[model samples]
Target: MSSGPTGQPSLVRTGAKAGLAFAGSAIKGGLLGLILGGGVFFFYLGQLKGPGNTAARAGGAGAILALVTSPPLLVAVLLLLFVVVYAMLGVQRGRTKAMQHLVAARGEAVSERLAGAIAGRIEAMPRTHGTLQRAADWLSVDALSKQLAPVLGEGKAVRSVVGFVLNRLPMSDMLAEWQEGRAAHGAPVAAEGAAQDPALRALLTRRINETLQEMSTPSRKPLYIALGAHAVLLGVGLWLVN
Candidate 1:
């Protein structure tokens, strides 16, 4: 069936070639996430039951360890971690893959045209929109995603394009920019020139580059997520082991 203005169905948009690429990237990242994540958790678990603690809980440790480290329990923990990490990276990989697919479908000229269109809209955002409003409408990942949907269609390419164009900065970053600039001065003076202020623009533009690099390099998001997830499992592992 046709889809959106592209007339290309979602399946066609992904294409077999792109799908395989996405899977390959996801699996590779998943394995990395698994190895790194598992290593950290294992290190912590060892520490928890390490030399000092192990001697103290020597008698109890064996029984608890048996239960916690059992084939079933170990598999479940690793499986959960793998799945979460896989999904996390999968979204990013899919976006990247979809964009490649989109480029294939539309060709470089059309792709650039689309890029120009989105950039034009963002650059044209009126100062009257207010700092927060402008940010909400044009300065956020989510907002860019929404904008990409209509022009880029509903494919994963939308997210990919958004990632390329904007960084997923925490609202606090912008809030800090706003607070330090405007609130501290005891005036919302920045509001009038927000969309056009060279300095503010430079700062946010710099932040955008920072975000883009994070998405491209992928930074440490997966590992960070892995750490947080394993922290919770650490408690459960201990509980079951005990």
Candidate 2:
């Protein structure tokens, strides 16, 4: 894996990008839902005014308040739920793309022995409990472990190796730098200190690339199914209301 001195592929960076994309989708969907729901509410309110003065007879303000607080708000909330589900699916798709890009950047796989050796070296280094244990735990690689368990089998050793890479090693700094570069063009680059440590850099890059490749696969099918179900429920609700 030949990352530039300043630019390394990182799961953290990929995740950040996915999160931002989801946020944008959510904001757009929410605004659209608000507009549509408001329009429906007003149209119904106007129609109600014409027929038998039903709204006025029912204590005008109370009827209007009830209408505003009920159907329109409910629709808006349902639409928001739909939007969140779709946006989550979009994030999954974005993650797959980001993984593919990272895998392509690496071009070839680094050997398992080499990766293991680097991991072992990092684990042997002295470090604070907070930095090593807690920091590794923070990466939430256990989520990855859960996903991969059926394929890779369950083991404490696997978890340890993951923790070593994520917490004990210098990969976090490289990942941080990658995130900075993504946030701004021509950002101040990370120093060449990591680049100088070829073994560490190569191992970190391989782990990140391999992890991305694995995650990019068909494991996200469940998310798509859930999103579809949410959309269907929203559609059914709207139809019933209409």
Best by TM-score: 2
Q: Which stretches of candidate 1 lie over 4 Å from their true place?
A: 1-20, 27-143, 146-154, 160-167, 178-188, 191-195, 218-242
Per-candidate TM-score against the hidden true structure: 0.37, 0.37
lDDT of 1 by residue, 61-141 (tens): 665675464543463456456546755776676556544654455433333433444334534656553444444355555
Candidate 2's C-alpha runs over 4 A off are 1-73, 107-210, 218-223, 235-242
What are the Cα lDDT values of the candidates? 0.53, 0.46
Considering only N, C-alpha and C atoms within 3 Å, which residue pairs clash in candidate 1? 64-241
Q: List model 2 lDDT by residue over 117-181, tens digit each.
A: 44444444445443433334334457644543443334453353344344444556644544465
